[model samples]
Target: MKSLMKTALAAAVFITASNAVDLKVLITDTLKNNQNLKADRYYQEAKQKSFQSVRNIYNPKLTGGLNYNRLDLDVRNTQVVNTAAAFVKFSMDLYDGGKNRALKNQKLYEYKAQKYQNISNVNQTILNVVTLYFNLKTIKENIEVYKEKGRALKAQYERIKSKYDLKMATQEDVLKLKSEYEANLYTIEELKYQKMQLIKNIELYSGVKVSRLDTSVIPDTNVKYSTTSDIKALEENLKASEESINIAKSSKKPQLKIEDTLSYYRYSDYNEKLLSDLPDKQNQLNISLTFNIFDTSTKSKVESSKYIKLATASRLEFAKKQAKTDFELARQKLLTQKEKIKSLQSAVDMANSVYNTVKIKYENGLVDNITYLDALSKKIYYIALYKQAQNELQIIKMEYYLKSGIDYKKLLSLLK
Candidate 1:
C-alpha cells in the first residue's frame, strides 16, 4: 500500500501538464529581465572600466598649449616687447617605487572581488525564483487537496440531511457532518490565502505572472561543490588589501620623473633683434628624483594598511568556516526531510486505506459517523503533510546545490 501510494503521488506531482510553465525557462527569463540584476551588471561594468583605467599609469603624457606675453620696459629705452610661443610637453614616470604597479594590482583585485560579488547575487536571485516557484506549487497542491476533501464532506453532509428528512439519521450525525464540512471549507480558504501570498512573492522575484508549474525536473541529491562566490570575493579582497599595503609602503621610497618640453617662439621685429641671444626654437629635457624627507604619516599609513590586510584575512577565514557550516546544515536538513517524507508517505497510505474502509462501513450503518469523519480528516491531513514534505524536499535539494556553489539552474537544465 505504501509503495502504491508513492507511485500514485509521484504520478500526480511529477507529471507535466500541457500548459505548465517550465521552471528552467522561467529562471532564464527572470535572470534576463530582472531589474536588480541589470543594475548589478552595470555596476560590474563600471568596476571593470575602473580597473582598465588604472592599467596604463606608466604610459607617457603629451600636452600642447599656446602662450602669449606682452612686456613694457620704461627703465632705460622705454622698449615694448611682445612674445608668443607654442610649446609641447612630454612627461613620464621613470620610476614610482612600485606605487603605480601596486595601485594597478589593487584596482584589478577590486574588480575581481566585485565580479565575484555579482556572481553571488546572481546565485541568490536564482534561489529566490526557484524557492518561490516551488512554494507556490506546494500551496496550490495543498489547496486542491483541501478543496477535494471539502467537496467530499459537503456531499456527505447532504446525504445525512436527506437521511434526517426521512427520519433515518440522528440530528447529532447531521450536525457533525455540517460542522466538519464548514471546517474543511475554512481550511481551504486559509490555504487559498497562503497560495495568494506565494503567487505575489513568485511574481516579485521572477517578474512574471504565476500559473501552473512543470514539476518534471527532479535534481539529484548527491551534493557536489566548489569554492563559493562569497569566499572568492573575500579572497580577492584579501589580495587587494595586501596590494594596499604595498601601495602604502611605496610612499617611503624615492620617485623619479622625466619631462621634455619643445617650444617655437615668435617675437616683434625689434624685440627679436634685441633678444637675438635667445633661439627661435628651444628644447629642454628634465629629470627629477624626490623622496619624502621627513613625513611622520608614512609609517602610520603603512601600519594601517597592514591592519586592514589582517582584518581581511580574518574575514576570509570566517567566510570559509561559515560556508562549510551552512553546507553541512543544508545537507543535514535534506536528509531529515527525506526521512520525514518516507514516514509521512506510509502514514498517508494507511490513513487513506482506513478512511476508505470506514467510509463504506459508515454508509452501511456498521460504524459511527464520528469514526468515519475522523478517518476522513486523518487521510486528508496525512496527504497534505506528505505532499508538503515532498515539495520541501525539492527546496532542500536546491539549497544544497546553492551551499555547494553549484548552479541550480544548470541542474534544472538537466531535465531536458
Candidate 2:
C-alpha cells in the first residue's frame, strides 16, 4: 500500500511538471497585448513630443503681412490715392529672465515623471495578471479536491446501499449518504463556475486565454525593499514643480528681446508726387529691455507656485512612508502564511491517519457508517486547507516581490 501511494504521488508530480506553463512567456505576452499598457505607451509618446516642442522655445519665428490704404481729402474730393505695403518680420527670445529655460526643464522633468508613471502602470498590470492567474490555478486545484471528496462519498454511499439491501444498514443511513453526495456535487459545480470567472478575468487583462497555469513558479521571499516606480515618479514630479517655481520667479526679472523686420512699399504716381520723400523700402533691427516695475500678478503667481511646490513635497513624503508600510506589511504576511502552511501540513497528516484508521474499522464492521463518513470528510477538509495555505504562501511571496520592486524576470527564473 505504501508503494502504491508513493507511485500515485510520483505520478501527480509528473503530471503537474509536464503541464507547467512558462510564466515568462505569459508575462511577455501580457505586456505586449494589454490595452491599458498600449494606451499608456501612446500617452508617453505624447509627453515626449511635448518635451521636444518645449525645447524649441528659442527657435526664430517668421511672420508676414500686407496692407492696402485709400485716402481722400475734402479739399480734393475729386482726387483719390491708393497705397500698398508688405512686410516680413523675424523675432526670437534673446532672453526672458531664464523663464524659457526653466519652463523647458520643467517639461523635460515632467516627461521623465510620465515615463516612470508608465513603468508603474506596467508593473501594476503585471501584478494583476499574476494575481488572477494564481487565483484561477488555486480554484482549479480546489475543484480537484472537491472531486476527490465526491469520489469517496460515492464509494461510501454504494457501501451503505449494499448493506441496506443485506439488512445490515437502515434506510436512514442510505438517505444520509445520498444527501451528502448531492451536496458535494453542488459544491463542485459552484467551484467550476468560480474557476470560469477567474479565467475570464485573466483573459480580459492579458488578452490570452488561459486553460492551465503552473504553480511551481517560486519567488525569492527574502528580498529587501527598493525604490519603487511610484517613488521615483513622485520624485520627478517634485523636481518639476520646483522648476515651475523658478519659472514663476523668473517673471519678475527684466526681459531682453531682439526684433528684425524687412519691408517693401509701393505708391501710385499720384501719391508719390504728393509725398515725395517717403522711403520705398526699409530694414530695421531693434533690441529692447522691458522690466516689470510693479506687476501685481507676478507676486501672487510666485506665491501660488511656491505653495504648490510645498504640496508636492508633502505628497512625496507621504508616498515614501506608504511604500515602506506596504513593504513591511507584505513581509509580515509572508511570514504568517509560511507558518500557516507548516501547521496545516501537520493537520493534513493527522487527518489522513485518522481517516485510514476509520476506513479499516468500517471494513471490519467496528464503526458505523456516519462515523466513517465523518472521518473521511475531516480528512478531505484538512487536505483542502493545506492546499489553500500552500497557494496563499505563493501569493504572499509574489506580493513581497512586487512590493520590493524585484524584477519580474528574476522571479520567473525561479520557476521549476
Give each model's whole-structure lDDT: 0.84, 0.82
Q: Give the TM-score of candidate 1.
A: 0.87
lDDT of 1 by residue, 1-416 (tens): 99999999877766546557788778888888788989988988998898887798675889999998776663222343667899999999988888889999999999899888988998888778877877778888888898889888888888889999999999999999888888878888888898889887777767887677776445675656679999999999999999998898888899999999999987663443455566688999999999888889989999999999999999899999999999999989988998999999899989989999999998889999889888998998999888888888877777788899875556666654
TM-score of each: 0.87, 0.87
Tens digits of lDDT, candidate 2, 5-47: 9999999988877676556667778889989999989988988
Cα TM-score of candidate 2? 0.87
Candidate 1 C-alpha error for residue 225, in Å: 3.9
Error at 90, model 1, angstroms: 1.7
